[model samples]
Target: MTDLVVPAVINLDVPGPVISRHLYGHFAEHLGRCVYGGLYVGEDSDLPNAGGIRLDVVEALRALDVPNLRWPGGCFADEYHWMDGVGPRDRRPVMVNTHWGGVEESNHFGTHEFMALCELLGAEPYISGNVGSGTVREMSDWVEYLTRDGDSPMVRLRRANGREEPWRVKFWGLGNEAWGCGGHMRAEQYAAEARRFGTYCRDHGGNRLYRVAAGANGDDYAWTETLMKQLGDLGCAHRPAPFMQALSFHHYTVPGSWEDKGDATVFDTDDHYRTMVAAARVDELLTGHSNVMDCYDPGRNVGLVLDEWGTWWNVEPGTNPGFLYQQNTLRDALVAALHFDVFHRHADRLVMANIAQTVNVLQAVILTDPDTGALVLTPTYHVFEMNKGHQDAASLRVDLPAGLPSREVGRASLTTVSLSASRRDGRVLVSLSNLDAAEAVDVELDLRGGAVADVRARVLTAGRLQDHNTPAAPDVVAPRPHEVSATGSGLRVPLPAHSFVTVEGRLA
Candidate 1:
């Protein structure tokens, strides 16, 4: 018997909130190659593309069942002029990407291109309107141009631009980060802007817009408090999205200080441990923000959207620093799993959460070298793929003993084990993360409610803590069949250290 053990009981009968597939959402910014090269390889390029959008990238994101894609900008959204991206590709005006690398923006992947990209991936389009530097008219016109049908000015403009029917764009962001790169506005001030922008950015035709207000930064409870009190409050108890359907928050797990966010490929155990501890902080932030929301909107009608959350490591060596590019590793995969565990636990209030990026920037799932058409799925990609079953599944609480296991890193102690479960389509899905850097832990999982049979499992693990996939060796850290032993009352699942595992079986 191993000294390190996790005894968990998954209650099958008790039902919990259904996990939103949008919780597995993705973000694509105009930063770095994420747009120009990563997702778009140009119409004339030799790489396979549909209307200039990379087909390989679309296929890869499609494999993950990507729920929705937030586009056009991060900081760029505030400075982005939607008009500059429409019309003929060459005739479109260009601007400088001041937020990322000070590179010139061709405005090629604008409103029309993004809609096409989303269609190819079968994902919903979540556009962040320019609220910081852009006017309410611009945001409203863009909304009308995308969703309004028939012969209006915006509709005429849309038809002239080549797309005949209006695209149904529901999820709209009022802004990015109003306190920072977005606009440098206070919570109260931004709330006013959100209300005004959301008002004019109306539901055209039958397309009702789900406007998302730019929300608090990490743990900025006052910001959330202010937004709910000012924007979300309908002068009553929990009005259902009076002005804004959701509020957005951005949090990234930077392993170290912003000056040095730890290296992507090179890091000591202490660095790795700290990253895990920081990754787990999302739960605390979620709880804090949720608690504040409960105070203002008890009915939880105003959903919380974590529009930006992921690891923000130092840019890869020799790469453009402002691009926020970094490699994903086994540790990064573990970070994603920890966030998902928390996301499932708070499924009732949290509607959607998009990783900082989908490709080539920050913690991207798919990295592509556009010049060579080389694309590799990061370790984080595998975690998303393995747990796709949990999307829209009923959350099942994982009850574990108080004293499970722990590892100390400085003042904080990392819980070496974490797990979450959900059920859908008559099957139970379980995800377990063993954070111990050296020893694998055996989990004695007790299955309750009704009997489960034909238990199967797969794991994402690597030899080294920093093991990652590159184009040359893309399969270095991929999921493979994992062994599951049937126990008297449950199952014995061995979770390797610094790894993530998911098990599934039909409920009888």
Candidate 2:
């Protein structure tokens, strides 16, 4: 039997930084069906679409209150040329997506189409510039084309293409994965390249560009230290800096080695346990990277952007291996909940995080069937929808008792319960997850600095660890009302085994 932990206390009077709503952001790459079949069905398709984008997927994303979306590539962003994608679709050039699946890509969904989708979803567009295979002139001109309000060659080109009013794009990434697929450059080499490319990415009108530098991969502290040192030297010398606002890091939770990532839906108890342990490592990664940044940036000027993160597993059987299509299980939902708690605790230094490949890809929230026009909301989707209250809310410090009892999985051990709390509009919201796969634990909630008037809760759980939503049965794992009662001192709720729960209450 798993030990029942002591009550977790939340001090509402003490508030931390406001959690940036951008932290709940999503990513839509140009890979697989993420763009063509999942999000865009074309203007001539029989499926209901608004300007080539599927209406159902748009409505589902809107419900999550998605704050921002990163676009165009993981590796695709590096090889992509902006000019080939702009003009009339019929006249535009066609290219193969060399980095992802080697599939042919029509220049139909270019800058204009992406901006239109952002407008429809009411999300801020974050465009990743091509620094690996693109010239400085190309990147600079692309920014000028989208943001320049004045009369210029690029502005004329935009008018010729179609859009008259310039769409505002604030966030700009200098490159994606400069250390690997993005040119395989050394840390110092990439630093100089970033400065060169970022120099001409000028601000246009009201859009002040926030340039994000490509950062370390996983626990590569050497990479983090090298870039920080080089940038700091340039800043101290009074040289023009690269409008650098944030540094990005990519980390995915893989239960095993990259070559043999465990199956998404065929996992047993041990596989499930190991996955949770791996997801919990995000806290360590953030702390190690933040410490390195502090050495060069004592004031914490540069924010940490976890731009790509989620579980990566073997592709579903018979699916195109390069397409990276995998089913999201209950385990994926817990991983998301764990990440949310970690992000909230470090909201001061970490500003934004986007789950990798938002649709029809790794750990996707929404999956669709092209032939039947059927849509399935994965378990991970419910977790995001339930935890939407934490966006931009004031973080409340949570106090968990000692001996929380770490569970062992393979060679690693992790705490059984992960938690985060926040207060907003006289309401306190607490999110909790029980990592144990077999034993349900009773958690006591002690509220300080306030009295609870009423309480309500929602939980996501299933009969089996591998249970997931399929196109035929979409409601297998979804949010359901959970039992909550107000104790004399606070509230008490039972956290089911391998479950994620969110409890909200009015303050008295």
Candidate 3:
């Protein structure tokens, strides 16, 4: 028997308040079948829908307890014009989605459709403004059109468009990427441009805006440093010159070749370890970016919004590659858990995080078939559903020592068993994942101050390392509840290799 002794007790209370709910937010770009056949099919379709939004899909997302949904685009966000999506569907302009597949966008679903979808799912709407190919006045006008109520032209337009009320949108993205498709502007240039664009946005009564600036790409420390240095404190920067509340970051887990991003389902052991290492980079990026923010604002008021994240790979066979469509599997589930673990640990600084696309796109939670009118949930969807309890909870750090063995693949490998604990409503919930692809992990939970009775647990795993869920077999990878015990020293749980687990302990 291998002697795996309990490491030092992880005293998470040292820093205090580790988990934040906005970190659980999601994204929905108008790409591929994601918007067309995936989420919105119009009431005319054979499938049951409410206000043109898929009912089954809405119910599924509601079940997952999605906190927020970001709309328009990744690059598409920068090109979208709010006015084009409003008014009579027949009268709305028909434009080509140049950034995604060059498909025709009939403007069937616009601002009202998206906001209404958020209303149905009981999730907040995060609007991404056009910055790359839009003017300052255009973006500011969008804010007024959706938020302003009394006598503004935007409000009048909303009344003319058949929706007489305002959306009261709070979370607003200044732009997306900016370094890449968002304009390819230098850091200093984008900083100045951000200040210019953000200046005109108005804050309507009833809804306080949380303006998010487009942040750096993965591992781009210089980008974060430049923005923080140029813009100053973001969270507290309500001075109107450059009103900013959060900074945004985008990272996708991709293998060496962007063309051949390994395989979505069939992969060897090396690929398993490589995925973990790629997913784990999010933690380092967060840490490095936060340190840069610390240099600018030592008070730590500004927030880091991981607005776009998830696994990116070659499209599933027969799907549009540019659309970023891929199958979800147990491997994707582990990636989701790893990100949640990272977010939970840095909850205080990481205000909001959204998985790349919700449906029919990169790392989607739900997938649909237009011909068959079928709907299915993916393994990543199960991971999100199981971790809903972590929303808006205080993070309590668990003890994890270094020297934990990791698998290395081209300088990337799995290291330690990452865990994030939180306390909310008389319950302490811990979300953990073992990055190990081979060995089972022995975890000891030290719930000294908190009550530790009747620990209910849910886990997502599979028989094979490369196990995944396909349209043919959607339920293959899902969460199953089990009972876990608490001991005198702590709670001892054996985590299987390459698994995602969520444990809930009742507090007295």
Candidate 4:
């Protein structure tokens, strides 16, 4: 029994800055086919590619309107050197990825290639700097090579490599997980290091750099406090200067055990409830981290970037665990929508977030079969596509009337339903989710002073909780279009249990 009611008209007039669709950002690392075969295939393959990147995948991401992409990492960003991946591909050096799949990383997909891929997808590129195993100059020079204009050493190198125009990359990360894969440094130490490395990142014309400093992992409040203090100190007359515009946080929902991580495609009601509970922590993490930041910067100049997030589970049997590739299920779709709603509600501080990986990796949107030349769209992909109407729009704080508890059976618990409303291009989109395993939600959406018509919905659900798509069965969990009508009381819809629905209405 889950119910939500509203007593007053909610004013959504204060549209925040269009949520950086980058918060809906995707990751691409040099692990497995994620680089070599998944995204970049070297221009010689017959896999329907453009300049070595998969055409179908690019088309899919473009349709979803993915705004930005994070490159060369998770853990790989810490050890990557920008110079090794530039210029001639064959002449480039190959380094062994110490953390992911322990596979050899060819310098084939370097800065130029990444920027090219971004052009194909029409998305912004957010390069993660190597602060863990790299020097201050390396970080600076990499920025110059990507953004600097003519006459600079890095710019000359860019021209020599066939790219005369500087790739206008705006978002950059100083480090990833400084406490773990990014070199085990204390918050204070990483904060100081971040100021130094970020100082030299030039803000080339039209490329306003959003330098992200290394931040906390999960609910680590001290890390945020310590880093904020250091940043404040550097900005004052006492130090080199604060160059960071944002701070990053990484959280993954790993049920059962962190090491074992369970499975990507197999799980029961208990596992589902526990996963939602764990996923709900993102809101807490963002709220707590924002509170700490407010203490340091009350005016809210610094933004919180949830850069690395998604579900992490054990690898499939016979699959390389470090590759981080797994099947995406309806469960993952709910997790994606849940996180998206949370980020939107906290849009003031939670500026950007990148899902773990884009392809052939954790929570990937597109999965390709090298053997069959087939591509499968994961359930997570449809959620992003359906929710595209919310990108870069103002959010309305929902006043959900007192509702029944979602459902609790043993250790399993559900939130019943969660809501987020946004307006884009004259359409009001209300995203509703029935998180319960067995109860469908009868919802009444009150639009207050506004009227809506030409209503419709795109429903994402399946017969089974663990249902997913395969190369052989690509349309398993696809969106089903349905007609809807707005009532005088509000919009009424029967949200199927364990399903996600996005109701769209043309403004009247």
> lDDT tens digits, residues 1-508, model 3?
1245344254433436746677778889989989888889998988899889999999999998888999987899888888889888889999888988888889898999998999998999999999899999999888888888889888888888887778869988988999999999888888888877777877888878888889998888898888777655445442322477778888889865776887788788878777888888888889989988877766677788988899988887887766878878788888888889888878768888999889989889998976787888888899888888888877776765544555557855567477777777777777777777777776777666545677788888888767766668877888887555566856776677778788886775
Candidate 2 stretches greater than 4 Å from native: 1-3, 233-242
Give the distance in Å from residue 165's predicted Cα in candidate 2 to where it truly belongs.
1.2
Ranking by lDDT: 1, 2, 4, 3
Candidate topping lDDT: 1
Residue pairs with colliding backbones in model 1 are none
Quote the positional error of residue 147 for candidate 3 in Å.
0.8
User: How many residue pairs clash per model?
Assistant: 0, 0, 3, 4
lDDT of 1 by residue, 247-315 (tens): 989899987898988888898788888998999999999999999888888888889999999999888
Residue pairs that clash (backbone atoms under 3 angstroms), model 2: none
TM-score of each: 0.98, 0.97, 0.95, 0.95
Q: How would you encode candidate 4's per-residue C-alpha lDDT over 1-508 as one tens digit per residue?
A: 2464322234444454466566788888777668877888778988788777878888988998889899888778999998998878899998998898678888888888889899998899989999999999998899888887868888888889898787788889998899888999988888888888888777876778889988888899999988788666432233313498888888988866876788887788888888888887788888999998887777678888988899888777777777777889999999998888888888877888998888988888888887887888899999999998888877766776565346664564556577788777777888877787776666777676567778888888999889999977888899998544456766676677789999887777
The 10-residue segment with the lowest total lDDT in model 2: 233-242
Location of the lowest summed lDDT over 10 successive residues in candidate 3? 1-10
Q: Which stretches of candidate 3 lie above 4 Å from their native place?
A: 1-15, 233-242, 401-405, 410-413
Candidate-wise lDDT, in order: 0.90, 0.88, 0.81, 0.81
TM-score for predicted model 1 compared with the true structure: 0.98
Q: Of 2 and 4, which scores higher on lDDT?
A: 2
